[model samples]
Target chain A: MNYFDAQTWIGGWPFSFQPAHRAATLARALRGEGIGRALVSPLDAVFAPEPTPANRALLRSCRTLRNLLPVPVINPALANWREQLAVVARDRSVRAIRILPNYHNYALTSSEVEAFVSEIQGRSLRLVISMRLIDERHEYFAMRLTGVPTGQLDRFLERHPDMPVLASGLYRTDLLSLLPRHPNLLADLSFAEWFDIVDQLVRRLGARQLAFASHTPFLITAAALAKLGQVGIGATDLTSIAHRNLERFLKT
Target chain B: MKEDGRGRAEAAELIAEAARFGIEHLVALGDVLVYGRRPAAEQVREINDDTAWLVQTFPGKVSGFCYLNPVLGEREVWREVERCLGWGARGIKLEIANNARDRCMQPVMAAAQAHGLVVLQHAWSMTQIRQRSYHTDPEDAALLAGRHPEVRIVMAHLTGCGIRGILAAKPHPNLFVDTSGAAPEAGILERAVDELGPERILYGSDVPVRDFRVAIARVTGSSLDAETRRRILFENARRLLKLP
Candidate 1:
């Protein structure tokens, strides 16, 4: 079955949109290589504030591509984060709200996001925590983006175990370190690299807890899709990591 | 570079998945540990030990790359190579210890030639990082390839090596770039394919350090043609390592 991408992207004012606006371009590129839908995160969320404007623009651009799903980014650290949360709450079109604690310079331990999590839980909103955005080495020299600390993610999961959060941009070390303790956290298969990520991760966390993320515009869409496509996963496990478990994740 | 007693276990895990995905052959590159602000010979040994263990346990499936320190004396460096060979290591791996063009590399290359082993040097465009003293830019690796024409050299980290690395690698047939490091930059892989062609591009994950699915998938799922993809992903590797 042709799978939908969970961690797609939307961005670009002048050139940033090359990757962001290139979702259809990316979709076409993937189709050339055999990929279908991608649930995207807006570039403005990581690089700009009030991602709604750019996101709205991206949603408009992706009108021709039905496969590109928008998962808007909401910085809980923002002053009007509540307003942003309200916007996502009102707009049923977006399936998930992705958070970048590292890029936003806050810990998951922040009481502010904790309360925001409650509001999200109250509204039954799906939360996808992005542990990182770009490769730490390749990031802008001035930018000091770090992965969400292991202890911080562990505590966040501890405080709210029922929340089925999808943490994209997670490191292999962090995933292995955290998975044994935090069963509630469902990670996107995009950033979790290491050696044999699929088998290692599935054995530890079970394929059901795993979901696919393409991290389009930043990473090769085909590369991300291949993880969900290839690896050692059976057809059943592929169903779960690519869509079934994510479907269950959104349902929760 | 966070460690949680999972690195060793996870290494085996990635190898298994890679094998199933037709990545049957593995090149166990030692986690260079960032040279960690002047890693002593003993620390380097520890890294090599982990790599050697990977190759030894799997024997046929895995090939270990030995880590080196050029700043250290010639004796220590040669000793490490001997130790690695003794432990069944397949080749030598270098990080930002010194530029590949530096005079220190002469001894390292000489030892590699003596041991009848290939040397994989971590290379990237110094244009991005701009730290040339220790880091071996593509230019440095190219210079090394020029210096050691008889000895086989693998320039590690293709995306980090970027356009210039591919260009630097193009002139020398003895030199090859592994499709590892950085996010798969758009067109860089294609550029490498166009310049170096598939035969010169080797597939490496920089595993535990970089994502296998991403790195492997980058080469396998690139914009290049099927024959080129096969060459980069498996054929090239099988030939390079002489694996069956």
Candidate 2:
């Protein structure tokens, strides 16, 4: 199966030893798990005061690696977010721009986010809002970040009903609550887990709303693949979730 | 009879599904949260009876673990432990009824020590929640293991415990950590193996609540060698439960 991971990161995460620290290593690892292409982000960007350098570094690293698509982090809270967005938008391979509301210390409901969304929509670029990269409870003792509030996300989704957004790192409950009301929202299967997760989600929200996400270097890539492969969903639903849905979502 | 039939069918399906993933045995830890954290003695018995039913019905395929609320006093704890032992419970499962460091756990730990039953304690890092009074932190579980060196204890939810939990488990040889709970974060299973060795790490699904395939992949997908994976996935658990 040619899986297109909607969520994955490369670069050192200070808290834990991220195995695939380079794009090539991550690409090789994902390929071993049958993931042909992955939408890549930078782990260093999550903790940086300004994400431009990390985003630049990611684009540089992924330049030669065709299967690794760069998804640069945009911190609208920073003064130079437009410049950051412009730099990444110049790259045709850059299909989506991700924002870390909790890490960047910005409210999803902030005026800056409204403008950022407007700019992203204007440029015809997709938006990927990361709910969290690591599980909040288990983060480093000093770091006290939490997943972006689902309430705020609901409001954001409500505000930008026309802008299609991919919310990564959502728990199963979050997905169930958010996906039903927001037709513009799509979720990655990085953090959403249950016994029969794929089948259950497909039954409730339809397969079109779900996409494959490894959350690699932070989460076990094979675990995500296992969730998708072992479920009893039909070939078409599986195909849609594996790559097709994400493909459509990015194109739109 | 109708409920029993439905339950049997469910159990059979579970076993068959698990078999597809090469799982031969399951440790039935009763719905630990069904009656809330501090379950009454009757509620404890009710949960155990359900687990007992699965054990009795499935025999070798399923092993029963007596779920206990440590706050339920010595008399009730002893009575339930004896009753569960009579029905062939291989271990005692503890949830958030009381902290592992609490005075209430003495009788419960004593019962397991006396009966030669392994204890699986629900432990997570309490740094974020701050509910250590009732919830078992990795430190609390490790302390419990330190207190009773005779009884083997499994600290559940390795991901929740995180790296701090791994270090806390280091000193106590009697303490083992299971690869379960939360998301299967990359490198945690590997870290556990590095710090505690593969023999002390057990593969746990946290199933019905967690996906079986994903849980298995947490170990299988790790960078560990085939031998270490085998130890974590099957051999260690088999040895811990003394399964024939």
Candidate 3:
């Protein structure tokens, strides 16, 4: 099955073993997992003070890899947030900007985000908020970062109610709670899990609100995809989840 | 009897769902401890009876594992095990009634060794959670395996145990880990194969609670070779369960 994965990362992690680190390696790995196209970001951007360098590096690495679309990370908390946006704008492959609010140590309610969202909207780029990279409970002892609270996300949506935001790494509960209040919000299935997750989600929220995300390298690609299978949902819904929704999200 | 009223799928439904991924047989481990850690003997009996009913209902499709709370002491543990075995329970299931390192596990392991039954213990990496007192951390499970060398032990929840759990099982040939519980973390199964070899691993769905697709994909989607993947998914469980 061909998939347009909305959530994925490239570059090395601080831990011991990583499935694929470099852009080419990650692209090949994604292809092996049947991901036809993926929105890729640099892992280094999450830690760096300014994401411009990492974002530039991501653009450079994914230059030849057509399947990998560079989604540069922009830390709005940093003074050089505009520069990061400028760097991504210079790269034609970049279609969206990813924000790590928790890792960057800023609440979604902050004026910084308000200005950042406005700027991103002005540039005609979509916004992807990474709620978290890993489960907080399993986070490295030294770096115990919590996910962006549902309340903050709700409030953030209230401010920019019409903004087409794609949030990654949200739990099932988080997705459900946020779904009703924020109709403009879209989520990826990378970090969510439950018995018959797709069925549950489709029953509650329509297929349009959901997209496929492998959370590759950090999460097993096949494992995330398999959740899509054996879910007892319709063929059209499955197709929508696996690729169409994501394709539409990127296009719009 | 109070149903969850949630319209949970039945065994036939589950089997059909699993069959999509080529899973023909399932090991039903009952509710384990529906009444919490130190369940009354009757509660244990009821849970096992339900498990036996599932085994009977599904016939060739399901295997039963008797749940025991060893904290109820040796007599209770042995009696329940005997009763469940009479109903065709092929193994023993131990939950968080106590840590594997506790003295209570002696009777549990002893009964398993005597009956030639596989002991499936719930375990996770307790480094951050710090619940090793009642919970079986990977280290405590490793200790349990060290103490009972003759008994074959299966530590449940490969993702929860993580790399620490794989390393914990490295020294004991009789000890194995099951790929159950939690979301599939990349590089974990590969590391498990690297550290413990393919034979020491088994595929587990933690079904009804976990989706069969996700659990199976954890092994199928890993970086392990086809043979190693086949071993973990089918061959190892077959050997452990003595299935033809």
Candidate 4:
């Protein structure tokens, strides 16, 4: 199956040593797990004050790797976010704009996010809201951040019903609460887990509503793949979840 | 008799499910949370009986662990352990009944030691949680291992235990960490291998709460070598359970 990882990062993460920090190495790691393409973002942007430099660096690094599509991080809380968006939008390979509401310390319900959503709609770029980067319980003692609240995400999804958004790093319970209400919401399987998880998600939300995500560098890539590969599901549904779902979501 | 047939069918399905993922033997740690923490003696028996049923029904394919509430004190603990032994329980499973360091654990550890049974303690890092008194932290489990050096102990949840938990289990040869609990983080299994050798780490699914395939892949898909993965996934578990 041609797998497309909807959540992956390349760059430095201060908390732990990531062997796949470079774009070439990360791509090779993802490919080893049979992931043909991935929506790549920069880990540097996650902690940076301004995401523009990291965004540009990501676009430059992933330029040669066709399978690694750059998904630039946009911190709308920053006053110069419009320029950041404009710069990353100019890159032809860019398909999605990722926002770290918790890491960037902004509420999804804030006026800044309202305007950010409007700008994303105008640009025809897909929006990926990262609910969390790592499990908060095991986070570094000095720098702990909770996941973006599901209630905030519900309101955000409710406000932008037409804008199809992919919410990454959601737990299984988070997906259960969010997916039913917002049909426009698409989720990745990076964090969602349970017995027969893929089949359960497909049964609950349908295959069209879910996408494959590795949450690479933070999680084992092949572990994420095994969630899909080892499940008892139809080939068509598997293909839809493996790549087709994200492909369709990205196109819109 | 009808219920027995239904249970056998269910057990068959479980074995088949494990077989689908190449899992040969299952260590049935009974639904540890069905009665909530600090289950009554009868509740503990009911849980172990359910496990004993699986072990009796499937013999070689299934190994039973007698779940105990250490707070139940010496008499009840001994009675239940002795009863479970007759039904073929190979290990003792302790959940969040009380902290592992509590005086109540004396009888439970003694029971395990007398019968030559391994002890699987439900342990996680108490760094974030406030309930260290009742909950068994990795540090507490390590203390338990230290107190009873003869007993073989498995500290459950490698991810929840984290780096601190790995370090806590380092000095004690008897304390093994299972690759279960929470989500599969990238480097934890590799880190565990580096800190403690392959034999000290065991593969665990925490099944139903965690996906079996995902848990297995956490070890298989890691940066660890083929031989180390084999030891963690199968050989270590086989040796630990004393499976022929």
Candidate 5:
């Protein structure tokens, strides 16, 4: 069955510039391997001082990719967040706006996060908080960033309980640590690695709480797909993880 | 059943059924958090106690190991290790307490050497996870092995540890890696054999967390020759744990 890559990146990044030429090559390779749809962001979000350029670039390139659905990165903390929203909200092509708190240097507790949440909600857009971009140990030594704190996440969820967030860039332990604290938070398992995170998550948090995210180019798409393929879930559960559930939150 | 210690016991109750899928051994690596980051001597005892119970419960089908954190200092590390060995644990398992090369690890490798215990250190690609402190990157495990060549160190998580990890582990003959943690990478196991050779690899499912079926299949379905496959899947582990 086809799986929707719930988390991905496109366009050249200023920090870790992965040009669409490179991204498209990787996506073309993955499409060869059977990933029909991918929810994409910009690597520029991980590096650039501004999100608009990469956001615009991601928007511009996704039209060429039938399988890729653009998920614009919005820094509600930025003074010109309205312009970013106007860009995204003008078209139904982009489904959700992803926020990178650690990368953007804003706390979920901050006014920008609050305003951003309210605006996304006003436009009836979904929220996705990127908890991390890479494994912490391997993160740039000079650009030390930490995952979003559970306490702040809890508070954010408590305050905005109506919003269903797709928390990408989470490791398995972060998912475990937050599962009991926040029921509204749904995590995409692109980076959660451990002894057997799939089965453990299925037991602790149902498959409904998860979606497939290849994290592509940065990770081997087949290897990531194989990770979920190797999960001992039934065809039904696997169906939800691979495509069905993600299709619900994403723009077709 | 929840996949805690209690859940594993329930898993043991179904060992016969699991055997149809070729699960001949279930290595009881403990629920681990019995001793959190800095485990007390009592907490270590409890972890080993549970390990012992699982080993005895499954008999030939199960092997028990002791988990230690040397950052707690020598006394606590030695006490639980010695007690677990006394209680019939097969080896020692180390988690993210400290890197394998840390001065803190000296006493731990010493204890394993003294007790003739096979030490399983939690290892992953620090290439991606750069924290070298408590997290033992594969290079650090290689450093540990370069120092204590006589003691056996099985670096954990073959996939998370990745190619560079296998290469880091290749220099020291005493260092072995188990096919545990993460889903099986498509070709890393083949790369492991090419780098470390087949004998240095062992088959382990960080079970209840990873799929034993796929973990076993990584070896069982490898591109390696038949003897090497047999060596990786059964013989290597059987020799390591000294299973009858």
Candidate 6:
């Protein structure tokens, strides 16, 4: 089945060794792993105080790669976030924009985040909220950034009940817990794992809520696909999680 | 298997799940030290007895590994090893009873050597966490292997051990690392192959705690050549266990 990676990154990471982060390399590598498309973001956005330069670089790098869709990172906490959003939204190719709440040092419940959600809805773009890029237990010692708490997500969802928000890098338990409360929240399968994860997830959350996400360059792409490939689920559900749900999530 | 301290899975269910994954053989390491890092003699016996029952019931499908708590003293360690071996156990399973580098392990290694059994030590790279006292870091496992060259030591959790864990296991020919623990981090299995060779690594699904599908993917989804992948997924483990 053709897969769409909802979580992927390009550009160098602060960590020691990372796989090929160039868009061209990533596109080829992901294709080899059976992924047809990826929602690409800039790794520089995780550490940078401002996200415009990194987002622009991501757009430039992915210009030629049709399969690699550039999803710009927007730090809503920054003073000129509206300007950054305007600059990013001008490109017709930009169907979605990502936000790093923990790294950007703002509460998800803040007015800035609420406004950003409203603006994305107004502009007809999808929103991808990165709960984490690295595993919390193994994050670089000095960097020490925790994942966005479920309570915060709960609160954020409460404020915007109708907005369709895609949360990347959530643990299986976290996903299941937050899911019951917030029906509008969708998740990528990048970080969720277990014995028969897909089967287990489908039984609890249903197939429509999940999208395939490899978190490539950071996670083994095949490992992510293996979950989809080996799970004991129906073909229709498999197709939904693998690509169709993500396809619908993106604005036309 | 994957026990998250919440619910319990039946043995019949586990067997069926393993069979579904096309797994014919299993290394039955008891829920050793589930009570804590240092379990009482009764707890140790109970855990090992559970493993024994599983092995006996499954017959050809499962091989039991005797759980030993060296900190419980040399006498208890030898007794459990001898008892479980008599029940057809082929190896010793050591959890966080104590550090692999601790003095307590000497007796455990001696028992494994005398019995001609493999030793699977639960290890991860504790560099950042720095709790090397009770937790068996890859370095400590390497140190144990380095000290007892005669004993075959399988360090558990490749991703948990990370690159440093692989590097530590590189020099010790007697040391092996298992592909278990943590989510599948990209490029780790390849780096492990480059540093320690495919034969030195074994595929392990810390099942129940981790998903069998994802665990298999950690090796199969890697960029290694088919032969190397085969070795990791099947051949190496088969040879190590001396199974047909």
lDDT tens per residue, model 3, B1-244: 1111122246546655667778888898876645777788898887777778777877888888888999999999999999988988889988888999999999999999999999999998787676789999988899999999999999999888888788989999999999986778888888888899889999998876777788888888877789999999989988998876
Q: Name the candidate, 1 or 4, with the larger DockQ value.
A: 4
lDDT of 3: 0.85
lDDT of 1 by residue, A14-125 (tens): 3121243466676676566555666776676666756667556666666677776667777788788787878756656666788888877888899889888888888877
Per-model C-alpha RMSD: 5.5, 2.3, 2.5, 2.5, 5.7, 2.2
Candidate 4 collision pairs: none
Best by lDDT: 2
Per-residue alpha-carbon lDDT of model 1 for B129-197, expressed as tens digits?
A: 658988888888998999888888999888787676788889899998888886665456877878887
User: What TM-score does the predicted chain A of each candidate obtain versus native chain A?
Assistant: 0.88, 0.97, 0.97, 0.97, 0.91, 0.97
How many pairs of residues in model 5 come into backbone collision? 9
RMSD of 2: 2.3
Clash count, candidate 1: 10
TM-score, each model? 0.74, 0.97, 0.94, 0.96, 0.71, 0.94
Ordering by TM-score: 2, 4, 3, 6, 1, 5
Model 3 CAPRI quality:
medium
For residues A41-133, could you state the per-residue lDDT of candidate 5 as single tens digits?
A: 887766677788888877877777777888889887789988888887776687788888887888999987787778778888888888876
RMSD of 3: 2.5
Residue pairs in clash, model 6 = A194-B211, A195-B211, B1-B207, B2-B207, B2-B208, B2-B209
Candidate 5 lDDT score at position B87: 64
**Cα lDDT listed for each candidate:** 0.74, 0.89, 0.85, 0.88, 0.74, 0.86
- Which candidate, 1 or 2, would have the higher lDDT against the true structure? 2
What TM-score quantifies how close candidate 4 is to the native fold?
0.96
| Local accuracy of candidate 5 as per-residue lDDT tens digits, B74-161 | 8888877878877687788888877787888888888889988998888877655647777888888889999999898899888777
Model 6: per-residue Cα lDDT over B1-244, one tens digit each: 4232322247547866887777878887877647887889998898888888887878888888888888999898888888988789889988887899999998899999998899999998775676778998888999999999999999999888888888889999999999998788877889999998779999999887788878887888887899998899888889988888
Q: Clashing residue pairs in candidate 3, if any?
A: none
Interface RMSD, every prediction, one decimal place: 3.8, 1.0, 1.4, 1.2, 6.5, 1.7
